[model samples]
Target: MTDHALQSPPSAPVRFPPGLIFACLALLGVLFLPLPETLPVAGQRMLAILAFAVVVWVTEAVSYEASAIMITALMAVLMGTAPTLADPAQTYGSSAGLSMALAGFASPALALVVGALFIAAAMTHTGLDKRIALVTLTKVGASTRRVLLGAMLVIVLLSLVVPSATARSACVVPIMMGVIAAFGVPLRSNIAAGLMIIVAQGTSVWNVGIQTAAAQNLLTVGFMDKMLGERVSWIDWLIAGAPWAVIMSLVLVALVLKLLPPESDNVPGGMDGVTRSLAALGPMTAAQKRLGGVSLVLLLAWATEGRLHPFDTTTTTYAGLVTLLLPRFGVMTWKDVQARIPWGTVIVFGVGISLGSALLSTHAGQWLGAQVVEHTGLDTLGTLGVFAILSAFLIVIHLGFASATALTSALLPILIAVLQTLPGDFSRVGMSMMLGFAVSFGFILPINAPQNMVCLGTETFTPRQFARVGLWVSAIGYVLLLVFASTYWSWLGWM
Candidate 1:
């Protein structure tokens, strides 16, 4: 094999540059400015400093984990909050930090993601996902237009099964590659551009379909809990969000098809040929059957989370436990499932949740919220407008950062704070709109989202092409959000 073929994939570094370190310190200093007269206790002040460090660290404005350690050290030395290294070490594992670290493990959403990973793994090992993709392509055939539509439909469906955009891209990209080669389609064809948009849109559109679809959805739920005392139930979330999700997804699909019309010759013959191709794929594997069974049950659980009466967590928790116990049932093994979970995602999610907790505990989020209210005024419509525009801008700015978890963690809290100051009815509408749009608009560049980077590697859509579609999509998406917030949400009685 060639050296390049034998080489391992490159891994991200753990250290920060001198400039980043200085910038982080500068931000930390600003966070401490006009330091509270009482200092919020040495321990609390230390935590405040640590929280700011984490905000930068998780955002990739600095290094991950490095900031956590720095905060520990600072607490031990400057704050004198701990008598010795051992005492500070205990603080490192405090309920606050540990709670954040445990966030991933504790989240039913994350557990659902873990379950989906196992499903993907089992499908791949059993040749089920590949078979499905092949069937899809052959059915769509050489028709560029049909292939584009089929690919989009397939991806949108897959979004239900695959929580992570990057994972969904990995599953679909190979199929596109095969189709491109078989049909003699140019890599830069309009079909390819359509596929790219489909992938990006698929990443977030379904988040509104179900509570477990995206981590950000759960974050919104948690924020609502803080603001309203009870988390938005799964059924409530679906009712409030599904209509918008469906409408926006259709709009996106139409926009992609219109903007990048597929080649005439590449269109599929008819539905009959597509059906026949799909039928050609043999029986589903045991793994696929088992995973699908569990997934269906999970879906039912999510759909009826509140109405069922016994307890909502019961259904979700049961689904997770069943997934973890599948090996004993002869469905899949612990080792098999363990290898599938995205450990990096778990870490990032944990860090994001931790930083969010810290922000709340330290009053940093409130401080930021206060600054915004002071500058923008807190009128209902004005607050909604500001959050919509600011969130759109931040989505682009996130390209410079690494962690979506961190960005959402910090911003959601502050956004929620601002929403609280609005009329009660407007608060729910405005906050939901901002959070939903923020997750959807991470399409300006590859670095804005891991999924975008995955598609970029397919050698299909160029960065320029992705950006062109993204710019238009982002504009339309935000406008739809504003309209929905101002109109549909109120119409549906969500407000």
Candidate 2:
């Protein structure tokens, strides 16, 4: 997402926010709920801290960066003071807890997220992203249908390079807005609404396909690495995710077009506006050429992971970032990109990992997983049944929280625990990967995702308008996931 500070669109109206309600209940739970015999002192305290983080994050009662710092401090004092199971005689030192809180910063997954931000900054700095977007958009005529398709193409192209969905949407929204102006239609017109919704929805579609596309995906990787002792490589993720993303991309365009048919069949001069935007960019500069080459190399490195090269995605991304920041060879300077880096995101992401790590290391995840298995009887279900229930659960829970990162941080550990404690012989890694994909289903609300909010800020569509399309997308997308799980994914041995 773009600097989240800028992406704050108006939210869904309510007498009370979900976070406030959850926070009150969470407080009650902490004060009254007895610790289970199977759960540790540390585990119980960790749950309290998790609840606190969830309330703060979901409510936006505080900035996410601030909440991360608060979580870190909470972990240090709370977990630090809890008695160790090994020898209730000893306590985890506060300093040691502090280190645990900051552990996510050291993760290779965090490194990749930072690298992606730098790459995104570079694309913006060198004008490569806008140039590329306009270049693709200009290719399709200004006809309303093709304009929608062109928007999707720009979304796909940028999702590959920009990595952050909010940032990708930020880049494309203005360009689409320009197209709407060129068409000589009101920004409130159906064509304008469809294009904006497509841009918003398309970013989400690709987030599922690419591993580096969203920070939450990286958080999933960090958990897999720390909890599962293995990680899904880049190529494998794409192979499993791309076909689904490709089909959904088509679905997104078709549904938006259907629900919000354009004001006119052919937007005469629509192509002209996109063309003028491209022409105003003039010829691509040398910096753009350099950035483009580096991004392509970085993308190739990503696609070839565990295949043509032994290097992990994080390493290759940093190598490319280094090229962009080098003295003479680099496309950008620290001064040029520093402000756009969204340091708050780094803080939130790091602490989120630390939070989840604390959960697993404390065996809090295991205890919770055991309870879920025992109570839900997920143990009795077949693999497909498990996926359906979990996927549906994720979609439902997603409604309460706005940030996918926060949702993943709070629930993924539990979900992972759920999978771990479930009895039977199913692919744990595969289920984790698919479940991670489910976390991206932030459809059904404008505020459900930051990217959606970015487009919402354009005022091209109302939240109700966006939600209408989102309802269809989420329902159909859910069904499509099941179909893929039963057939294509099974054929690929992913399930």
Candidate 3:
């Protein structure tokens, strides 16, 4: 992927908006005033805090970092003060209770998110991402259409090594600029829009094919391991998900070409320029060598960790990260890595873990799952019907979330809780894995995924264009996923 310069336009100065302040105050008053008879005190407090956080996230009432911090603070304070049905014998503020509310900060998955960020930063810092893109494009040849397909393939391949879509998108954008310059394509031309959208969608779609490809996939895997005691190996995930990813990538190539319709159909010197750039890179730098070496070590560790059972995913991932930051052998300095890591994402993941734990600890997940099952009678629909219902819900639910990690952190536990009510043959792990794939299905808006945000930063595609054309791509991908989940997954003994 090409490392594109992706500085977003600056927003207006921050001033506390009156409406948001009023809404926050009103929300606090309503939530803290009294407990509903049907809701447990702990659950109520958790719900109130989550509700506030979601509103803040959705409305941008505050910065994301501020919202995440506020959520943690609110959860710790509120849950510490409330009593819960889970432990009628003890108060909510007990060490055990506080652990339930504040465990997000200590979550292994949270550590993994931080580690992944460092790995991505290391790749960017070392210019390894650009080297990969130039080398791939050189062999991909000169046809513009072929270059587009080649670019998509490169993005998919990057998922195997570059776990972060943001990292890959950042890398790919600068490369796309080279292509634009080669073709003399205007910045706002349809060709530019098409290319940018392909990078955005391609990175997101391929993430599902590999278990280690996305943070949210790991989060879901971790949740399922804890909730159902079922561990999905890399091979198992690839078998079930790789087809969906490949099919989606092919569809995306078609969708972007049809919807965006690039103004130029050919690039006369695209391959020559790519080859020249690759030649200029000459040999891999020491930083690139070190980053590449550690990346492989981490990949191998993650792939074998389930069978070997040596260390948790967090530990395995961080081990590679720590090696990258080692003083002499490392690729990047701690200060540089720290400045580059997206702490906001880490904060969100931590708070999300805490929130999910609080929900389970208070039996909120079980209660909500029961209510959903009672109202929908989904379990009575038989295995296939239940699968269809849940899959549809998961696919469409992406509209509400911007961060796939945050979405997975919050939803997987509830989905697992819901599955516990179904028949034994339903395969909770399979269903949860299917939903995990759908977490990457947030294609309809710029705010839906980090890759989408990266595309928006390019100022090429409008939100409305994304929502309109993206709806078709998302719908096609959903139907294809459903077909596979019902057929191939069942054939493989996963359904």
Write candidate 2's Cα lDDT for 1-495 as tens digits.
568878879897757656656765785587368877888888888888888877877677767887788788888887778887788889988987888889889988888889889898888888899998999987887688888888888888898889888788888888888888888998788988998999888888888998888999988988888888888988788888888999998998899888898768975576888888888988989899999999899889988888899999889999998899999888889999999999998888888899899888888888988888898888999999999999999998888788898898899989988988887887788888899899999888888899999999998899888889888889988998899889888887767
Instruction: Give each model a TM-score.
Output: 0.80, 0.94, 0.89
Weakest 10 consecutive residues of candidate 2 by summed lDDT: 15-24
Query: For residue 132, what is the lDDT in candidate 3?
Result: 82
Report lDDT (Cα) of residue 29, candidate 3.
66
What are the per-residue Cα lDDT tens digits for candidate 3 across 430-470?
A: 88888888888878888888888987887876787677668
Clashes of each: 6, 1, 6
Instruction: Pick the lDDT winner.
Output: 2
lDDT of each: 0.59, 0.86, 0.76
Model 1, poorest ten-residue lDDT window? 79-88
Candidate 1 clashes between residue pairs 3 or more apart in a chain or in different chains: 142-266, 143-266, 143-267, 144-266, 144-267, 327-332
What is the per-residue lDDT of model 1 for residues 275-307, given as tens digits with 9 covering 90 to 100? 544566567766666666665666677667767
Per-candidate RMSD, Å: 6.0, 6.1, 6.5
